[model samples]
Target chain A: MAHSGINLIFEGQNLPRLLGGLWITIRVALIAIIAGGVLGIFLGVLRTFKNRFLRFILRLYLEFFRIVPTVVLLFLFYYILPKSMNLNLPAAEVATLVFTLWMAAEASDIVRGALISVPQHQVDSGLAIGLNRSQLYYYVLIPQSLKLMLPAMMNLISRIIKTTSLLLLISVLDVINVGQQIIEANQKQYPQGAFWVYGVIFVLYFLICYPFSLLAKKLQKD
Target chain B: MSWQIIQQSLPMFQKGFILTLQMSALGILGAIILGLMCSLCQYFKIPVLKQIVGAYIELSRNTPLLIQLFFIYYGLPGIGLKLSAYTCGIIGLIFLGGSYMAEGFSGGFDGIPNSQIESGKAIGLSQGQLTRYVVFPQGFALSIPALAANIIFLIKETSIFTVIAIPELTNTALDLIGLYYHTNEYLLVLVVGYAIILIPLSIILTWLERRIRYGTFGD
Candidate 1:
């Protein structure tokens, strides 16, 4: 009754464990995306502000995140931050924090691009119509920018989801971690478990992300 | 931040940096070649191969490199393909980067005007000649920015090669930290190491992109 070969992936609740791990990945990504999206929009708006000092600081912030690899950031947060700050945080929390920051940086860039892409004449007309700055942005700019930003945002969302796989390196028990555990456990019974297990995880990620990518393409076309 | 730890680990970090550079160079070169082939296949609409390339691009792009590395490093051995970690790292990078590069290249291909191709054909150029003369140069120029972005991306992705135990920058930092626990210093070293590599690489690429956009390369 021993499950052999690929069957080892399903044997004794392995599949569910992998699903649970994937759930963690999705949950972290969702939380990061939602929180990061809001922060990103605010930063994006700020990024377009005319103040040179603020823009300079924001540019530094963006470039810092862009230049530093996420894994290094993960270590900085998961290991160094706790010791330095004397705060104990879970690996998942650290993962989420780093991801949220990264997402915000990228999303802000997209938002900034989208906002700037609105025709200058549109802004001028809004201003000439006696719209206040906030009113003009709310009524004239935000709506138009949303369309331009949507496809890119969707693409970013998929990218963030794919990136959550890195959380496993920090020991967050993500889908990859779960797959590894399953493989190690079944190494004797199914020497090929890594192939099937990782293949399945790959498929799971593809199933989740491919739709978003396709949707992004469609949205761009529209 | 203890300066001594950084001083002590300077050699380790340097070795890792060089290794990272070598790996990235090989991976980027391989990816460019693979990407060109794939884009050309798509551009020509080769029968069966086009669909296969399409599927490959999606599969490669959709999955994380970490899992791909895992599959390559741990899984392939099951089928008797056993490869060294360094080989696995390069292969993994090429696999992941190839898709992105293909997209970048195909975008370039798409930018080539229909008239350009038609003109080339009217000029008595054969199919090979048309591809060589008309499409490739213009397409490559158009794709330079995207391809540069992909190059930087692939380089950043080399950070993940640590998972497969390649002695890249991140892995070296992690290893030294594990041994010494001078977390802050090593982390600083890691960031500085990446900064040294990535910042210059990006700056150079941006320069190259600008040159291609406006310099003699464009004309």
Candidate 2:
């Protein structure tokens, strides 16, 4: 029996459920970007600190997060940490925590790269103007670096939105998980719902990512 | 910090590590071949083939690997074409990695100045001979850094296989964590497992990049 019924897949109540899931997806991504951005910038600066020990520690932090897959990190946070620490939290919270850690590490690298790309002469000239170290960084370094970093940061945000799909595996009802639910519920009548469901997911993700890619291109042009 | 758990988990983790390595090896090979073919298509200006390759690159690059994996694993089965999770994962990796690698290879192609190609032709070299003797070697050399980075990316991306129940490193770590419930130790194990594999990989890549830049084999 070919279950090519679109009505069965897009049943009465599933639309709302999917919309809810989409909302959660956006919420998680936004929160992660903000929290991760602040922490990433801080760590990025810490990475360039003159103190060798601090830089070493920051490097270790960066390497650990960069190498480990986010799924493993999510598993660690959601399953392992609770047992080890004897603390229980909601799945959404765990997803947020884990993704924040992941994003912070990624964003920190972007920030570091952006900061380093600024011309050294600009910093030197700021210093020559009797600007203190803090003043030079805040007044000169940051302004120029932000322009370079914005596009990269936008790219990172798009990445985060797409990666939020992984949160589905951890029991967070994101859009992909919602699609899974619709597929399961209507499997008999809409056996081919997996195609439509995943196709919709691809469209949703493209919608989220394509704009940022365009923005990155525009920023590069400017 | 506990040796007891490490001892218990060693066999499983080791097995998973080997599986991860194999998957990445296959994925990297598939990606290199596909990427090279696609790059060549664009370079040679094959009209329709180039446009199709460009479309494939954009579609693959712009989407998440997890969705692509699910599409292959779950969606294909719906159409009565079932593949094992490992196969699906490998296909997904190839599709994703190929696009990124094409970008890198194209970058390599663009880096060669027009004069180089023209000069080779002026020397009475046939196109094939010129590409083989001149363009190919230099383009490959210039692309070493990008190729190395893509290799690392492919390694990390293999983690997505866990969702489809592939017995790779992350899946093994999850299984171990589920078995022991010793969160800290298991998390530590997970961290160590990835670090041991990736750190050396990163070092080797960095060294390869440096070697390519300086045209010497010293670290």
Candidate 3:
């Protein structure tokens, strides 16, 4: 073998580059999750609105995100938007935006389910106590919804992080991309370079996601 | 966008579209079978196999599908286990989708009351008969919604194989885009191609889910 275990990875600048890429991956996932969570919470509340047009429009947005694959959205947003509308955003920013769209749509559904699952009596009792709209939500509705949403939201966040791997397709230089970069840089030197490269990538992703999912499950049973 | 180019490219799209369907169909079938095995192992608490199967599902679930694909496609070749891109793509899907379907199946399998199995034993049924008759039918019935959801998820995920240059619909569209530079036209074609498969699949799965819920489980 031209190369052996961890040698390609820890070589000068290779490890740092991959680590930098991992940081970016986590950063993007974080930004998307936070921004998506806020917007999703708002849109999810809108979904429960009594107004026909509001509900219809929100439903359309949700369905559109649901139906379209993130890879398609990535290509469309990364390429088409910049070309046609001249948005002039970097590829990473565009990728983040598309990811946010997916995360928000999914979070909207989760929030909707969690919010709706709160018993009618809780809301009625809150209203019976003359709590105004904001007060009722803050005091009664939001607390229960948070509890119900916690596990699913945890799972959702982990999922969003995992989905960020699609960034490789967009040339986002995520860890997966970094691994590919390592493989390419050493492909001639190390024929079996992909094994070590992807093995490390898998470990990095699993470390990031497994704990979150486990936490979600733990919280769920509690 | 070049509408004329799209019109001419319909045949290419059709060829790629059919492959996507085949991959998804085969992938989903493979996943369901593997998932059922995993679920059965967990349900029976089979000796070392249960923990191994559980870990396999968890690991598959936790990691990104892209790495899994690469691990199978590029990494496996290191061990002289080379497979074609199409085969690798489907294998990746089967395992990834299997993890999901296993989770779905386990949800239903775990929910099957112990009494049902005990009743099966009392009736002089073997473990196989108990699983086939007492467990699988009810578990599958209970799992329809989740399994249907998994199917939809699996279908959408078939697009990921484009990374491996699988000549699936997305890959074909990418190639067309490179050729035509009519970005909108090819992208639209890609979206419509996926919609044609997924929209109908989703609708059918939903209908099946509802039918099972009412027809088997009852109101």
Best candidate according to lDDT: 1
Q: What would the per-residue lDDT of candidate 2 be over residues B69-137, giving only the tens digit for each residue?
A: 988999888779899998898899999999889988987887776787888999899989998987887
Best by DockQ: 1
The CAPRI-style docking tier of model 3 reads high
Local distance difference test, per candidate? 0.91, 0.84, 0.88
* TM-score ranking from best candidate downward: 1, 3, 2
Question: Model 1 misses residue A30 by how many Å?
Answer: 0.5
Q: Is candidate 1 or candidate 3 better by lDDT?
A: 1
* Candidate 1 chain A TM-score vs. reference chain A: 0.96
Q: What is the TM-score of each candidate against the true structure?
A: 0.96, 0.92, 0.95
RMSD, candidate 3, Å? 1.9
C-alpha RMSD over true interface residues, each candidate: 0.7, 1.6, 0.9
Indicate whether candidate 1 or candidate 3 has the larger DockQ: 1
Higher-TM-score candidate of 1 and 2: 1
- Model 1, range B1-219, lDDT digits (tens) per residue? 777778989999999999999999999999999999999899999999999999999999999999899989988898789999999999999999999999999998898878888888888999999888878788888899999989988989999999989999999999998998888899998999999988998999989877775233245
Window of ten residues with lowest summed lDDT in model 1 chain B: B210-219
TM-score of chain A of 3: 0.95
TM-score of 2: 0.92
Number of the candidate with higher DockQ, 2 or 3 = 3
